[model samples]
Target: MIAALRIPLMSLLAAAVLAGCGPNFAERSKTAEELTDEVIYQDRRRPPSRLRDVLFSRTDPAKVGGVNKYLWNASLEVLNFLPVQSVDPFTGTIVTGYGTPPGTGRAYRATILISDPALDARSLNLALQTRSGPVSVGTQRAVEDAIMTRARQLRDRDSRF
Candidate 1:
């Protein structure tokens, strides 16, 4: 009688333990499309995606973030007149202390942000400031255009290899 009860009790304990286990591997594993959908359409209540941050986060061996190298080089080349204060290649941001452009009496500072790896207009953002205050919109746009153009040229030049 005790042996019979022991078998039943053991079976009951096994079932209880197994019941707490989460879904099987097949159910837990998500397809690429499913993961993409879930990440893009995440609910407001949930915290921002740690996965997205990891995927896009810069882990380049040479730099801090995954910013476009071409754009970064081109930005420094184009704005070489200014004194660079800080640069984060991973995020593609270059901050200049202050320097007068050649042939200009006015002093100016610059902050360049290359947000994407693509050599495109939208990827480059330029903020220029004079001793007085922020520069005009036209000036900022012009700087952006110049950096993007230079970035494209750099990419083209590199691809020739």
Candidate 2:
């Protein structure tokens, strides 16, 4: 019947139209490699082309999440007794669960923040807490001072290289 023919004709017409929507591969155009290169180079947002460059490029240490690497490493080294709960290098924050220091009976937890790129006392923030409550200011300051001293030692050792 005409109605049955109309369905087939419409399908055929739709198929032809849809087929034309694809790229015309028969025409000469940029090859895959050329197209890829164009896309990569044309955009300024693209990362380095070589893996080695991306991995080993000499960038400013301060550019790493605005954190002093010495302070970060020092905090981890000094607080290695505590079990690390979470560490975000990008945010320059380290959180550790309760763990007693060597020769200490009471368990303590710590949160360290490296707020600046400078290897100075002001860049390191330390909060120590015991199961009872927050530790006294003197204890907090002592821990912070240890971290800063260690950070200086690390920087000094690195500078010798």
Candidate 3:
């Protein structure tokens, strides 16, 4: 009968279309098996991880959690008036002997600690001293502000490259 023939023909057409639509899971699994013997697969577990992982890793040789160079240099440059008693770049500490500023009669000393390499406000710690004892809060704050501003300027200048 014509109706029976049409039903079989439609079934055959549907099967053909579905087969050609795309590779099924079995075909995909077979392709993956074939690719397993490739060099890419062999090196998949190699060092340095995948590209995405390396992008997030810390790989910069110059950067450490220690003192920031910009802040260190800026501290020295800003506090050049004071006589440097000692400086340890490895430990990120600067101890200065008391000395009078050019326009002021007050003798001041400073102990600067660059705790971090980032040019952030918290990285630069300034301890100002006078002949009597620690200087006023306003004076300490003003000096800290000056050092932080200078440190930022230094960082910005270096970033241009």
Candidate 4:
């Protein structure tokens, strides 16, 4: 019947969508570690992050968790796929901001002072630059809070523990 056909069609669509979805957090974390190690650690020509030159080069990044991770990840989320040209670990400055333009309804900027290089890039400044939905302020805050909460959990679980 039509109902039977509809159900299968919907299920097939769902499966396709799910299959196309990317890796989750754990996978991303592993990939990031590998990439960082190869690019920043092994490649001596590249400037070293605190993590890269220190004893914890591999194990040390583990000491930071929660908002830090969220903060770092958020930078990557905002930056998305921009290539890097220059960097200074002492300060947080990405120089370039990527993603949708601000007028479209979503944007923000956060200038974070970074003391560690193991985090994402050293952007002495990060401006989210997105269009704000009708309720964007609260929603963004909520999202930031969730990131902080997750960060707190990460810090507690990984570093503090």
lDDT score, candidate 4, position 118: 40
Query: What's model 3's lDDT at 74?
Result: 81
Query: For every candidate structure, what is the RMSD over all alpha carbons to the true structure, in angstroms?
Result: 11.0, 9.1, 11.7, 24.0
| Number of the predicted model whose TM-score against the real structure is largest | 2
lDDT of 2 by residue, 1-161 (tens): 99989999999999999999988979988889778877877864456789998899887753456688888998999899999999998789999999999997999999988888887888788889999999999989889988888988988888888
1-161, model 4: which lDDT tens digit per residue? 99879999999999999977966655535567677768766854444557647654544353233223444545445444444444443244444433343455344333334345343333223333343423356644564554445544555666555
Candidate achieving higher TM-score, 2 or 4: 2
Window of ten residues with lowest summed lDDT in model 2: 57-66
Q: Rate the local accuracy (lDDT) of all candidates.
A: 0.80, 0.87, 0.81, 0.47
**Deviation from native of the Cα of residue 106 in model 1, angstroms:** 1.0
Candidate 2: pairs in clash: none
Q: What's the TM-score of each model vs. the native? A: 0.62, 0.67, 0.60, 0.30
Candidate 3 steric clashes: 0
Scored against the true structure, residue 1 in model 1 reaches a CA lDDT of 94
Off by over 4 Å in 4: 1-70, 73-88, 94-96, 100-127, 131-136
Residue-wise C-alpha lDDT for candidate 3, range 49-140, written one tens digit per residue: 58988788765433333677777888899899999989988778999998988898989999988887666888878889898998999999
By TM-score rank, best first, the candidates go: 2, 1, 3, 4
Worst 10 residues of 1 by lDDT: 57-66
